[model samples]
Target: MAEPRVSGDVKAAFALLITLAALTSLLGVGALGWVVAPICIVLGIYCVLRAPLRSTMLTLMFFALTLENPSEMPAAGQWQSPFYMVGALLLTHFKTVIGGPWFFGGMDLMLAAAGVHWFVKLRGRSRGIPTPKPMIKLAHLCYATIAFTFVIGKLNGGGDSSMAVWQIDRVMYLPAVFLLCQAAFTQPKDYMSVGKVILVAATIRALISMYVRAIVPATVDPISGESDLPYTTTHHDSMLFGAAVVLIVALIIQRTGPKALRLAVLLLPILFGGMVANDRRMVWVQIILVFAALYLITEPNAFKRKLQRFALFMVPVGVAYVAVGWNQKGGAFKPVQIIRSAVDSDSDESTAWRDLENFNLIYTIRTKPLVGIGYGHGFWEVWPLPQVDYILERFIPHNSILGIWCYGGYVGFTGLTLLWVAGVYFGVRAYHHCKEPYDKAAALVSFGTILIYYVQCFGDLGLGTFTGVFLIAPSLAIACKLAVKSGAWPSALRPRQTA
Candidate 1:
């Protein structure tokens, strides 16, 4: 007689059920507890099974949801809920990483996980894990400065709300994420996997955007004649999708996978349509700059052929855009018409407000050139409109470089600038060093992503916001890791090989 075997999946399911039963018995007394008990237990089991990868995936999912439904997600603090789940998981499985039992949890769990992983790796310094390079060291310093700046702001009665301070602190996770990549990623495929995950997330985001736009069509304001929906939010979503599109196109050119290329090509029009519908002038500028940079960086012959194919592919997209515009009265999808609409300073209040904002930020930076005003605090003395109550609530400069200068001071701004420079340097180095076509393409796309973000910083909030950090940080980390693995870094700084 054969004994029945319990598979790993069955064992996992049983363990989950037992855990849920125990949790329900102990804490599920009320109706609310009964509901929470099962959910918590399931998340606990999931964390135990996958640990940090699960954490990363959840983080990405949160971003995707936010992009898809920003208006809905923040209504009941729903946007921050995923972070709570991730925090709980990390705390429950603290033994898996170096850290243990953290109380203050949120997206900060990502930081804690990275910190613990780095601490454990420190014990194995002889095992070929290199010392932190100047760029990485500076990144750590920037993270510390961000924390110190927030504390100083709070102590000085600068910061308004506890939540605001927490929001600022979440950006600090960027440095920790970068450090985690150095430890976690050891090969080109690992880096490629990161890109694939991001692209898939973006694809989901695009679908969601299409769904939302379809369900809730933009309404026209009778007085202003502008669309009632928030264009900036849509533009930001489009930017994320645009970055994903660029990465995919670059990978396809690098010949990473024929199937991926085919799929990406199929989705190109959908993604581009979302961008056009968003109608952000700066986003369009960014798309152009990104493609231009990609063209310049890739091999000439390969780029030329790719461009010819792309031009032919875009003919249909051009016709579709024209048709979409034709459906609307007085709307034409000519390039000139779109560009003129974007730069219509007379009609565009947003652009006018941005100009004024930048002037005020620059004036404030002149006063405190060293460190600017601390976090959560804005310079209202120089505000153009002191009468408006909401004007006083303007904490960020709405421009990443200016925001850095205002919040972190000159030192912080310089540190951030150097971080971008380091990113580009590493990306280029990785591209040059990698032998395989696909690896080179990945490196090139990574470089383009950072470069595009840098260009985007001039007009929009760049690294200061979660969205900007989410888009750029992981790619930068992967680029740096790839550079290190390819021995593009100087020999003295290279990780030593252990017996």
Candidate 2:
């Protein structure tokens, strides 16, 4: 497929520029940084100046994965913790002066300081920080869709003002981070560095999960006398562990860099153990889908062919195991139990509720049908909803992809779908274009992460959350950037175009 460069990317660049400026200035980004957020700004500048690639490995966000987002009210997800962490240092939300309209927090300071560096370092470049053209356009489309939808919402008196704004803000994080990532990461080494950081952070998160699991006692159902492990981590950790497993496996498969197999062997077991300990059924589904997608994207080779034959041979045995183990009481068939819990809603209360919730979202779409009920509006429930402990049900759904279709209607859904599919498409193209083993491994990892992201979106509220945006946006950037480097796609550079 020909990856054509489009006109008006300059406009997109200008839009990003505007976003950065607006965030910094209008948000009072660092009005009181001297007292509270100095570390974040200093850290951002340090990363950019000292070693943009290496220094950013894990400073700002590793701690974020472990904590919840309480700095802001009605915490969206753990990913939101970064934005609130600065104020959270005092364990309090900054009043209107510091974190209010005139003040920004740690995350705000970091982004502002980093944006300044990005603009200065990549100054006067036409490649415009190496972003994909279509993504730039889609970012604009997303913002425009929000405007259109909000007008419809306001006219109809559709939803709560605050919830609507919160949803819209989360929606923008995807494209905004997409732009930031494209501009910030400048080379293959940057991707490799960031990937290593992700592995380390996620590995640590897994360890904490294991610790939590060990301490938390299982809750026995009063009626059935069945014990269930309390969820130790958020659903988003599944993405973290799943991506790590895939990346390490690819490294082992390709032997991409020095001591790659040794490194993979060291980390793979821990990540897998973490997944089992976390006890998320979706992890298995995501890993299976990501591995399958990775296989499809990669060029056929002797090892892959052998693996295919082995899989084919195991198909019958795998089926029989599932068939027999579906109802087995033995703990030896736990993997089957997990898989069964995913597909057979009767096996788990979580899955059963999701199924019922999905019906409500589907019914909502059926009624709205066209422009959606618009943003801020709650999905109309056709049936009584089972009470969930989660309070954000009206705004964010477990099946966020379905929620997008339910809330944004056809136009919004199409825009997001294009971005999602295009990410994998470009990732595959990058994989084929890269010649070096390391580059190939990087592309493969990025590709698998994006696929895992898809699973997260469907199985949980992954699409609009900060975790999903940050993960996918950066992975998407790596793929798009690598594709440009490998001459599979055009860069935004104005002068001597050489890949």
Candidate 3:
């Protein structure tokens, strides 16, 4: 969708940022960034205090689009990201004492501010503010799971207590952010703004992806290099790539004009460039699944009928193409190659590793089916695999669904299952009950995003990462908010009736 008008506040924020960036260039960034850093922090603090919700969203966007997760820390051939500095500000504990602080640093403060404002506004009986009861219940479920798992782990002597805490925190990050987003929003339409911002952010991220692709060698080894080489970016980016595609498609439909065309023309190439350049096969699979999901959720129409007709003819051709390209090495078979590399362990070492890891996780669950090995312990290895540099290999598994089942046993698995099931239920209800097209379209976007995120967590280690939480939390919040607005969800608390 074409973005709304550029407001004065947005202009001001950009101008202020541009001025700060200018200082970095004029005084030599490397040597003098120290001087500018504190100034920026002070300014940031002021901005957050003045406008917590907007600032919170922007920070999330930065996390989603700018920073890389620890899994893929120094992206090859690209300039270094200011990861540790920014990550510390977001993730480190900010203490006023020598000992550990009571607070959770900047992120906690931001949420606290936003939560307080939400309470004040709701107390005054503000119209259009959503009360997501389902989301609130789901948050409790998530926290309870963590608490239960942590205690079980400690009692069982699973492993490092601190590491156990960190492991559970990462998993709980989604529900925590989901609550914050639910509180921060005042109206259903607010979701559209979040969607637009993420789309734009993904586009910018795609540009960076293109740059990384250009400078690096496409493959590390001559034979099997395509599969042997690491993914073009982080594993989580497969989610982002799929997100950009579905969001653009869902937003642009049912609209016409130069604006629509221009939006598609301008953003699609950059977004797709990042997607293609990134060279992760899962993105392609996720994209197809998301589109199918969106189609199934939406009401049937002429466009869909046409698509069915198109598919009837193309299905055989697609089958034939796959038959021929399954073993071919030509560029025409690139999509087929990606599919093969993803599923066949022989073609890609990464896939083989995940398969072995899956067996290990399954064994871990079978051994401790009730309380689980808890969060602190590593997955029990029936088929031990070589250790990688990743420190949380034991804690975080590629198949997060199975990982949860193993870590938390039946109880934690129930929590995760209910959370996502509730999210999907709300998304579908919102889409069907929407009174307006914008509402419907937004519901679709949120639904598709949540689905893509689930695919990531199922296939990759997305459940325990910042990127996945940032991507999924906002979308889940939006879905519930829309469902409530559309009356598909009953009011959590009835408003005061005025005479």
Runs in model 2 deviating more than 4 A are 1-58, 61-105, 116-123, 126-129, 224-229, 491-499
| C-alpha lDDT values of all predictions | 0.59, 0.67, 0.70
- Summed backbone clashes in each candidate are 1, 3, 0
**Tens-digit lDDT string for candidate 1 (356-473):** 7777888877877786667767755476642443432356445666767776677667755677778888888888888887778778877877876775667665544445566667
TM-score of each model, in listed order: 0.73, 0.81, 0.85
lDDT of 3 by residue, 50-84 (tens): 55454456565565555544335434424444443
Evaluate residue 385 in candidate 1 and report its C-alpha lDDT on the 0 to 100 scale: 44
Winner on TM-score (1 vs 2): 2
Instruction: Give the root-mean-square deviation of each candidate in angstroms.
Output: 7.8, 8.3, 4.5
Against the hidden true structure, what lDDT does model 1 obtain? 0.59
Model 2, global lDDT = 0.67
